[model samples]
Target: MSTTHQPTPATARPVGPPTKHQLAVMIWVAVFPTLTVLNLALGDWLGTLTPVVRTFVLATIAVPIVIYGLMPQLHKLRVRLLSRA
Candidate 1:
């Protein structure tokens, strides 16, 4: 007697990791905020010279905001990937 096995089609495959573009976006989304906070801390510690420079420096807070917004989504993605393995 012989046994045979078959695999499902591509469309049947489970959705997994974020695509390359999504991964890139995710990384940028995560990193931007962290970098922003870093920039702000540096600016404050070093004391930027002008109002325009300060405004730009303050904009670094957006890094945490962006990251906070994405945390849930990233967490969800992480859980899905881990469970699959």
Candidate 2:
């Protein structure tokens, strides 16, 4: 009896880390929705603050949600998408 090992298909290989451009695109995609929701939910309250304060508040709120919440899901989605293609 002989045993032969076949190489895995490309699609079966583990996906690599995202490139800088991919990361940038993911960030942009994450930010657009985050901003939209934040604006709708807090536009009136945030409007009360000065521009700098408003930006700071938005960044504070949006960054974590994007980095921790949205980004991982997006990365998974990206991996699924690339694997299909």
Candidate 3:
């Protein structure tokens, strides 16, 4: 006798790491707010620098905060949420 394969249901929870598109969204979600808040808080101080220098400084600071500080927390949240499914 032959067996038939069944497709996963639409509501099925996904396993494994996020897809490329999902990762992009997660990065954007982490980066936008961090950059906005930093820019608002440091606007006056950063104003003295040229555009390129300002961008460089912002990126340098933002990268660490996003990667080290925020990404871990976000990943935890994702895992918790997915686990509930």
Using lDDT as the measure, the top candidate is: 2
For candidate 3, lDDT tens digit of each residue in 37-72?
A: 999999999999999999999999999999999988
- The superposed Cα distance between candidate 1 and the true structure at residue 12, in angstroms, equals 12
Backbone clashes in model 2, listed as residue pairs:
none
TM-scores of the models, in the order given: 0.39, 0.82, 0.78
List model 2 lDDT by residue over 1-85, tens digit each.
Answer: 7786543584377789999999999999999999999999999999999999999999999999999999999999999887765
Candidate order, lDDT descending? 2, 3, 1
Please identify model 1 stretches exceeding 4 Å from their true place.
1-14, 44-85
Model 3, residue pairs in steric clash: none
Worst 10 contiguous positions by lDDT, candidate 3: 4-13
Candidate 1: worst 10 consecutive residues by lDDT?
Answer: 4-13
**Best candidate (score: TM-score):** 2
Model 3 alpha-carbon drift over 4 Å, by segment: 1-14
Which is the winner by TM-score between candidate 2 and candidate 3?
A: 2
Off by over 4 Å in 2: 1-11
Clashes of 3: 0
